[model samples]
Target: MMATIVKGGSFVIDSSSWESIMTPEDLSEEQTLIAEAAEHFIENEVLPHDGELEKLDYKLTVQLIRKAGELGLLGVDVPEKYGGLGLDKVSSTLISEKLAKGSSFALSVGAHVGIGTLPIVFFGTPEQKRKYLPDLADGSKIAAYCLTEPSSGSDALGARATAKLSDDRTHYVLNGAKQFITNAGFADVFIVYAKIDGKHFSAFIVERTMEGVSIGPEEKKMGIKGSSTCPLILDQVKVPVDNLLGEPGKGHVIAFNILNIGRFKLGAGCVGAAKDAISLSAAYANERTQFGKPISSFPLIGEKLADMNIATFVLESMVYRTAGLIDAVLQNIDHGSDAAGVQSAKGIAEYALECSINKVFGTEALDFVADEGVQIHGGYGFIQEYKIERIYRDSRINRIFEGTNEINRLLITGTLLKKAMKGELPLMEHAQSVQESMLEPTEQSDTDERFAQEKRLLATAKQIFLLVGGQAVQTYGLELEEQQEVLARLSDMMIAIYAMESALLRAEKITAKSGEKRGELASIMTSVYVHDTFASIERAAKQSVAAMASGDLLSLQLSVLRKWTRHTPPDTIRLKRQVAEKVKAAERYVVV
Candidate 1:
């Protein structure tokens, strides 16, 4: 395992090497094979039954989940002693990504393998693991994540669900409702969160057969319709004392840390779904003719495909790179030890900012691609007869899933500021450095380098973030948390910086490994994304600065922003056209 060279939330101020980060291009043969197997399974088994699953066939969903377990797909993250393969984060991530090609079936498996089963794998005790992990691993028992309640979607701590110790002291009676529970229809096991005695937030392993446990009717949803989503009604459900996950009052720790991990997998799944949309649209573009030529041949259609391709390419890079960060920390831990749960949760929590960033960016990017896919398919895209229609519908829930994009956005900046305050990341110091550097003479960058233009632009974007962020700090001080607008805009800038750097570093790595000629596509995609992203960051920074201050104060900030945003963007039209040619030729996301 590579030692963690960049601390969590430190990428904003840290300089990283192209070779230090991992990319899809760096996947080992074993990891690649596992991903391929998952892809094969999705194509052969799940997609073939799309119609049945779409009809909300609960039995088929159960059977398919077991089939996934039979392949050891469900156990990739589980420890070996407990009947799991205990693979690294990369393999599990790839499996998550690949399963997404099967549409909403991916949601069922994702809910099962990720939020459903992982809490036990990571936090359950020896007896808990011995009893539950094997059944979960073998698919004999299905799992569901029950966190969101009707009243408290984003504010998890605001949960009204209550748990009280039974008079016999042998069990706890759980009484509450968990809403939008994925796999609730058929899950044998549920990881439920409720307030202990209506006060302390806690997690519990609730069995399906527990007395007074019942599932509400499946929701009539906008997307991911195949995935069973129902309300879990806990009416005096008696859960054994041993089933309390982690600790009595430390459930928030378990819940938030598990959410970070869920965000990671959610990001990967979005990437896979986006790829499927791209391929489907590309194929349709070639087959559908308009005025004596294929729509794929039209520049307008090509442009949409190119933009979609670049966004997904960068999102893919961000996901795998973040996975590498998680794996590096997870590598040395002894999974069998009692402290493994705490240790693993800490490891996963380290990258909470990136996880949220991925969740927001990946989902939004997939939504854009799915929308374009339908557009490219023309009228057919809207009809149920076309797969893109379902893809479009499924894409909407992602923004709201894991956490709403709005919540994740707030968390992204909220976590960053909290890190700054705690001295975990040198964000304030970094911002100060940027402030001081503005007075110094700017150094001219070498324009002859492999990606001189893009490197300069990315650097400027970071500086812009630092400058604006520093000003916000100087103005707001401790009260900045209430400035949601400013903080959210800061998050936008941070997201831009992260995505641009991820793509740029990945392109650089590819160039170094495969020669400049062979790495042109990667480089081109990086350049295009960085150009567009930098423009977006410029606006976000200015908007943030304006919102924080007005009149002369805003002018001073705007001047600094103008200085940083002065770099000319690459010719995106030509670059994107070249990108379109490659994607149109391949009819898929070939950058992988």
Candidate 2:
């Protein structure tokens, strides 16, 4: 099958070679060793202190972060010149995934490595990097990102913070309150975004010792309480001119580009957290007996476990595939070049759609895994003593973090449309082809019988998406921005499409490597995911078409959608049982 992808504002998808993408199964020996080290750190340091960390022990949290830095876990993406390991995106993703098992401690490290430090790594000046990167890399200085204000959450540009130039042009006086600042209570550095003279939006590096900089009392939260979340009060804090990050009035560039990286990393973290939840839930089921057998022996409980494993598999596949794609693009750029920062940011931004898709899909998948885990634990799941309970709470914030799932959904379609408008992606042309296909009888394409049905369903899902999405775009034009519900539905279809494709490709790769017999489990899981998600794709497409069209037009579109979506539903019960047997035997997620 052919596909188009936008990278660095250009189309880079080669139809004939489109199937080549990385998967978790491709991890190298060295990468595996790095992941093992992170796992060891989590087991030795983070997990043992879970209780103390939960009690908001800021000192222990800082100590843990420093320990991670000492172990080189905090500098996976930073350049070696900056006292970092300067690893690839995949390695960084692996670290994020492993750290996620640490629970709230993972959030502390994630914010530090992602939003907190990337601005300097990606956009800071030579002096800025020289002064801060070493300390950040070595964990001597902890960092926090101050973006959301009480008045601004998703509307980040609406921040009330103001920075004014001093009379001598030596410093900018910053005044504002940033709410829910992660790592606020203990972070030594903060990436603050404030409007200059209440006009030009910008970002600044503010030190904890700066005059008039103070953190409010930590907010008692629902989840991840081990990580500090507080309001930062900048009461006429004077930040030196040298601390300005990026260019004046161009803070959004940093804010957004860094967020793209954060979104994918957040997805990777979710994958790790989901795996942890699956392991705990499966172990609990194996131990807890009801009637004559363990709860895991029950089909209903087994089904839940199977579903969790399946979702985690798909999420892991997508996360690594994206990381590999980003890494491949970034590897070609010289990190020391003057324009490297811009090039790097563009490289990451190239897959903004995929990043947002991963964020929305991975977080929701983790939430599902966590919820089912709690369900499998029954009453024990609700008790704080149970790890599942804390996991349930911790998973809640992911949807709202990076960007709200809603915002990310909008971004998914919005970015695709922008790329289409810029001629960077041929989405419109593909949509036009789908529209044309609807006018004629369906034409069959040859494929290996092993995945023929899935391949066909995937193609149809894309058609449904293009049909509805194209109609919406044409009907509303620029006003399509207001059709958020329709746009969200379209985003759902795209998310499902991407998820299914990732799983299918991974399964195909494994099957090719190990043959059909050895790859049976992957084939089963992929089939289950693709078949089930195709139904969801059809539903979302139909809903979008219904909302955008009416009467005869809506009816006609629905008919065409049905034609494309037609497929025999697989025996998912049998598939789930097969998946469950593997998961049960392994005592955890075993797709890898």
Candidate 3:
């Protein structure tokens, strides 16, 4: 075993004690317009047809997507030059989230617009763009990305499907299959990746009209059943020479780059779904009575509601932050340049940690929030007629499809560490201040005691990230093959910490100008969040450290476990009421 040793003296100031910069802001004018427009389309078009869609009416689903296109929702991310609305990444995310209020319909629409069509829009040649993008942007044609094989779920690049190049190399004969493909049953254009020459991979724009292309019966799923998912079969599917996307032997780039965009969009969708779930939970809690009173009146139920709101708030902030970062990168790419934003890769790469972090944290957070929503409802949550049940079911796939949380965890931790090792992060001035205040902690505010612990854990985590992340890159050569899981965990923790910090920071701002009530909520929530995060981060750090260290592994594990237990704080049933009331008053998830 090659044990990696990291010097412990490399210090990052535990600045989590400082106020956070992450918080959910009101949508900008354009974002509000886009969100409302999407909401209107979903309410008017999708909700009314739920009965038809439940029967697996493909025609109805197709019609609805077309209507979405007509409303310009489909083209939200496309440029105006290509018949799209030419919206930025934030707009797309906002639209996706708002549409998610419609549940499965939101997913169906997201699938058609995001994974189905974005690759061609971003990486396609002008002729290719002219050929496919217009239909995709107009929602006249549906799209799908075929990369997952039965044997290769998250290991997409290791797909077994093969495509053979002809003797003239003018065209390729594709022979392979893609399984569990979203929108497989109805997509007009398929972005299929296959191994060529037995080693290199290539991407092709395979159409449904192709001679040897077919879709198997839809696979029954736990949720999102209304959105078609099935196997895409290619039996000697003869693809045209011009159908090739990007260069030969470079399909991995196309697959991964597009996937990066897909994951980010998927994160946006989760944020939307999370918001919807919280809304549903709050409404249900406010109405449904138990023990002769509205369930929302109970402290435990109130806490659950508060948790749901806070989790959603975290997701929204992180999703938009990621959108802002990705937008800056995509916009900086000169349209006239043939470089295809390769030089601007650092922009996306800079947030790779954030993207995967959001993917894991946001999805899992929503899952927990939704589950609690169902729990609070008691029996109605499980009934088929209730939307919460469907939302719960639909939410399950979000964590699984867009790179399982397991895979995402690795990417998150690995990316954070790698970035640190590469010295890409500019160092902030190191400082620490401890102030003892008797002020009660608020719902989203950080208590000094709790904040201090988080600061220490984050500082240590950054060190571990650099140590393990640097060694992994050096040994494994930056593909993140072996170090993915560790990276993912690290990334998840970072996102949670970031979200918690953001909420706390925002609460502080509100409290400073406002009265004690707001400040109290902020302080209490902050205490709970910061302390909880401190414990979680410490656990993850200890695990990663143990994985890299050469000491008595069992002893290290027990020490970390004991450390966590010793630091854990008492349960806050009282503090939760403050969080619940604020969220209820706002009628949605408000940062404070």
Q: Estimate each model's TM-score.
A: 0.98, 0.97, 0.83
In model 2, which residue pairs have backbone atoms overlapping below 3 Å?
A: none
The model with the greater TM-score, 1 or 3, is 1
lDDT of 3: 0.69
* Candidate 3: tens digits of C-alpha lDDT, residues 1-592: 2212111112232333222232335347888788888888878878888867866678888888898888899997665667787676778888878787776667777777876777776677778877888899888999888989989988888888888888888778999889988788788999999988667788889999999999999998888878888999999888988998878888887776666667777877888777777777888788887779887778788888888876676567567756755666567566544344343343465566566667777778878988998998789999988888988988888788778878777665555455456664432112111111112231233356534554444444454334334444444565656665556555655665666555555555556556556566666666566666666766665666566555575465445335333444646666667788876666566555
On a 0 to 100 scale, what is the lDDT of residue 251 in model 2?
A: 96
In candidate 2, what residue range of length 10 has the lowest lDDT sum? Answer: 9-18
Candidate 3: TM-score?
0.83
Off by over 4 Å in 2: 1-19, 443-448
Give each model's whole-structure lDDT.
0.89, 0.89, 0.69
The most accurate candidate by TM-score is 1
Model 1 lowest lDDT segment of ten: 438-447
Q: For model 3, where is the 10-residue window of minimal lDDT?
A: 429-438
For residues 1-592, write the lDDT of model 1, one tens digit per residue. 3565468878888878898898998999999899989988998988899899999898998888899989999999888889999889999999999999888888988888888888988789889989999999989999999988999989988998899998899998999999999999999999999888888888999999988999999999998888899999999999999999988888888888888999889999999999999999999999999999999999999999999999999999999999999989888899878668678889899899999999999999999999999999999999999999999998998888888888888899889888888988888888888888876666655568888888888888888888888988899988987888888888988888999999999999999998888889999999899888888998998888888888887787788777667765667889889999999999998673
Clashing pairs for predicted structure model 1, backbone only: none
Question: Which segments of candidate 1 are over 4 A away from where they belong?
Answer: 443-445
Best-matching candidate per lDDT: 1
